[model samples]
Target chain A: MGPATQRVAGPAGPPPEPKGAIMALTQASGTRTEPRRPSRKGTLTALLFLAPFFVLFFAFTVFPVLYSCYLSLFKDKAAGLGLGAVQKVFVGGENYLRALTDPAYTSSFGNIAVYCLIYIPVMIVLSLSIALLLDSAAAKARGFFRLAFYLPNIVPGLIAAVIWLYLYTPEISPIVDAVKASGGTWDLSSTLAAYFSISNITVWMHTGYNVILFYAALQAVPKEVLEAATVDGAGPFRTAVAIKARMIAGAVSVATLFTVVGAMQLFAEPLLLKTKATAITSTWTPNMFIYDAAFDKHDFGYAAASALTFAVLIGVMSWAVTKLGSKADQ
Target chain B: MRKIRKTHVVVAVAGALSAALLAGCSSGTAPAAQSTRSGPVEITFSSWLKGSKQVVEAFNASHPDIKVTFKEVASSKDNYPALTNQVKAGNAPDVVTVEYPHVSEMATQGVLQDISKPAGDFVKSKFDPAAQSLVTFGGATWGVPLDAGVLEFFYREDLFTKYGIEVPKTWAEYEAAAAKVATADPAVRLGSTVVGDSALMAALSWQNGAKWGGVDGDSWKIDVNSQASMDAMKVHQDLFDKKLVWADDDPVLQKKQAAGQMLSVISGAWYGAALRSSFPDQAGKWRVAPLPAPTSAPATAFYGGSTFGISKNSTKADAGVKFIEWMTTDPAAISARIGGTSSTFPINTEANAAAAKTFDKAFFGGQDIYANAAAGLKTVPSGWTWTPGTPTTFSKLADGGAQVKAGKATLSQILDQAQDATVADLKNRGISIK
Candidate 1:
């Protein structure tokens, strides 16, 4: 069967290829004696195989991104009490200027900056430590523990935030009750408290998934190197810190990169938490600013401009993270 | 070769899958064309109000020529985004539910159709002038009013009597009652701040003769932090400062009520039904009264209500307007809605008796809430027009309220901020502000 049929058949189908053969096949193709010429018939076949993906991708993704860019240049202008027909007036860079100048929109960047500072380090350290513990030889029930650690990631992020919202609310939370009984006060009414509460949720939901990623990278370390370390009188802690961690530095860097991007796109958690926490405003994050502009204010042009600006910011941040990550890996 | 044949099969499969996807995308547009030639003119109605399904069923069962398909959406805050998105995507329902405050904004944005030709006369003749003013803007009708949420005070009779606090008649007495409740028990509060509900805050301001903004000749005027508005807001701020009320949304407020920590709530007439559903255990203890006025003169304002508008993209505007008319004015539709325990005060004067008859007053301890609502409705000051930047105004006000709650700012400062932010937003949107 062709690759399409195999994919459609899913898990019930026979293996598409032996796991190890993929590596050998790539090597074989790379070391061909002569470069094969692309025949017109072969090119036609390749295009036919790629047609569906290109069509769906262009329809859903590329067009919307381009259309939003176009929409960002023009705004709807109404006259005479705004009950008459509206006109789309093109004003280049004006929307972007407005978004940049608005204090609420600019402050949202500060909110996410603080959020990333707390969320990223805590997530990386906690997940990496857990990965090390699970990878150690002394750990029992490795398979069960790995699955147990990964379970929280399986719950949708919005659902996870909702569950955490209940746990954070003062009226219904058992946590708050316990704290009060112990002569302590738990309140999420401050901006700092909201930041930590949101960070706590992201860490809880994502740390487990990162653990699995780091653990898999740790498993791939060669046995001979680890045995050599043991022969050099390296204890469990030394081996874990010096050998396994060094071996999985690439995985850790990749996880950090992903976490940075995820932190910048914080919308749903804070949006839900804003109901309970008086400190969390409608424009608490970049995405929420776009949402409030578009839906609440009905200023789609400003929303589009803010969205594009936010996208460029995210792109620059991602590039910086990748550069830093690769430098750390080297 | 074998690979060539496999590629051919893959190409065929991909083509078929894409064809299926294309078919699925085209199907949404096909029904509108088919309905034009069909037996019944099928129209889609989107609403989030209670008893919408029963009202649609009742309409469909009675009418043979027109059929309505009801789609339930989230509350107005969430639904407006979805509605506007649908309008932009060219897949909007024929009838859409919009709140009174949002009508001006939606109509100005071209999300709703100007149904002045089809249903304006009916709206003018059937609905009162106050209701008519809310729907008609810039010499055109954009929607049909369903209910008028006249402000009322909901209190627990048992708690008020036990605390020896008479129902408040003026704002001064209300403050005294709040103080009395706090002195009697530190746990119980007399009322709530409703910190995030800008609508309630606006209603309070409106009751105290605060005209936030209105059209002045050609340009729009916005005065959100007017003296009257600040005076009304400061009362609540004082209560908040004294810790005499619980500051929370409805869900948390309901929890406080269940714990017997909150004793009363100042809300719209519709909240009477909501109180029953939310606190069914305290059914016999609750009572409805007119809202306390700032002066000896009794005055109130509309708080929470919705209207039906035909989407600008709908090809069935006539059918949609018919459905809206029936839903808003017909006794049968009123009965069906009230049967679901919706205590909405219908804006149609003729349908008020029908709705009042159908509503279960036993939930409010047999108190005649309709008479109180009618009294409250008579006192709603006129000449208060909603601006296109009202949604932004409310959101900013709510944010300001949050700041006040956090002790970073006061209510008066937030009012100024809300006013300045709304003016800036309007100017950004190319709307003229005076």
Candidate 2:
């Protein structure tokens, strides 16, 4: 994975690994922790297992991405509906500049900025509250409630967005009709309003998965520590927040990192809502904007340029998030 | 030791799975385009047209040598992008429908083959001159003119009569009627803009002599937010501000049209057919007229139409041309297309008249709606070409319009940004935008 990553910029390479080479070396040495170095035969066996993974990994993920990076550097020059042979010119940083200045590309990033602002903290808080409730003695039918909460997560992102789009639409949605009947508005007309409407779908679809993770982390907390806190006359709420939440800080930080990454790649929900919400253009997210450039616009060079620049942006963001998350762990 | 062995086995299994996937992916070879020893050579027609299969069936019933099949690219919104991808991948359908806005873009991007050698003479002598001008870019013929989506005024006869409004022949009169009708009834609307369709705005601007995008000498000229466009936008802004036209750009605007609450629309001839199907209850209440012009000049705009072309990757270019030749000029092909569920105004002059003959009077209260369309066809403004970045340009324009609807930006401000953005976008694509 490390070699494959070096070959192409991975959009997500593991948030905790500050420098991949150091991480790999430490792991290799620490795993066989002994006075003697690991045998050559042991290394050969590991290589045999890793070789196939590297081949597939490089062929699919690394090659296409690196090729995209390569393609971004060149420009296709042809004349008159391009009748003659295509002339390829290498214009090193020009495509990157074009993407940076492009209103369509830049505006899509703004849409993500709005999405991340509202979705992340709200989702984390909701999932944590639900997980604590389920872990507490007050909650009955724990298994059934957990299953019901986790059910929406199992639905594919595309299907879930489609289901929610129908529900968001005023003419079809009974919820929307009921709201309107009671003189309340569920307006998906304006851009900011539409963002909220679309953001609600992300929250509904993903909150359950986080709930399950938080619950699992709670289950792993030491029974003795929990009993000690309870025996000392700590109330359920205090024990849940102060003890259980603190114990699962590792899981919570990991979950937060993933949520930050997922929020940035938002495309399908807003894309499905395009017809229902007119403000949501095809270029509504960075990923969808890149998809249009490559496929719809057939400006592969421009699309590739945007993809590489986006990768760098994501890397920077993940780095910042990891730093912030790790400091809080202390 | 047991744990380490199990973990090693898991990694080994994962490695095997990925290796197998890689092998499976690389196994399939590219299909050879030409026939080896075939009785009938089949070609694919990729389009967004609804009932395209009927035309292919009619073509096959006559020409047994070259058979064509239909493959839908995407919905109208994503059709060009889908087509662009297929062409780039080298397996694009031989007979693909290139819409007017994408005609120049596709050609310049090298998706289309130069049809000048095979069907150039046939296209020039048979198709309308205006349609010819659109397909021929960079001094070479590129496509077979399938249809012309000439814009016309479709209004409700009963509403106009009830409001004491005569059929408007000029923009000033049209505005007056819209104001009068809206004032007469609070629930009623004059019309609605196609919120998702930038072509509708471009079509109106075309009528007002806005050279939104075109080729001149060797350089491309794209004037999306020019003074003429401002003139067109100004009129629409007036209508919208005064509540003369409903600001509802929803697909649900069809609901208003069905109920006869919306009085009129200035859309392509295809939109009239849509009324026949989508709003059958409004039958015998609607009528057609020439598009209201700014001056006394008889000018209309082109909105939605497809131009059939052979893909550059097709091995059977000769057979492809033969199919296109029949599809464009032949009477049988024209009738099948005109009768289809989502057909447009026929591009062939004679076909236009012939299709007009087949118009059902029951739908339009015995009004010859196609007759108005036929007359308007003569006035569809020409010399307006498209750029490769047209889809991006349209998206920007529509987004800006959405912003205006949200009251975040003024019409002039948004449009000025759109024009400059379009020039930059085209230039960045290595296109000559001067």
lDDT of 2 by residue, B1-434 (tens): 76578668767776787777666545433454568566888878887775577778898898887778888766866766666666666668888788888877788777888888888888889877778777887788888887778898888889888878888888888789888888899888777754335788788888888878776777777788889988887777777667787776454576677777888888888887888888877888888889889888878988788788888777787888888877776677777866645436777867666566655667888887777777887887767776666776787777777776666666666668778777766666666666
Worst 10 residues of 1 chain A by lDDT: A1-10
Residue-wise C-alpha lDDT for candidate 2, range A75-97, written one tens digit per residue: 88765334456678898988899
What does candidate 1 score on TM?
0.91
TM-score evaluated only on chain B, model 2: 0.90
Residue pairs in collision within model 1: none
Q: What is the lDDT for B175 in model 2?
A: 83
Task: Give the number of the best model, judged by TM-score.
Answer: 1
Which 10 successive residues of model 2 chain B have the least lDDT summed?
Answer: B24-33
Docking class of 1: acceptable
After superposition, the stretches of candidate 2 with alpha carbons farther than 4 Å from their true spots are A1-55, A79-84, A100-110, A170-172, A175-191, A274-284, A315-330, B1-33, B36-38, B194-196, B338-343, B357-359
The DockQ scores of all candidates, in the order shown, are 0.41, 0.21
By lDDT, the best candidate is 1
Q: In model 1, what is the error at residue A194, expressed in angstroms?
A: 1.4
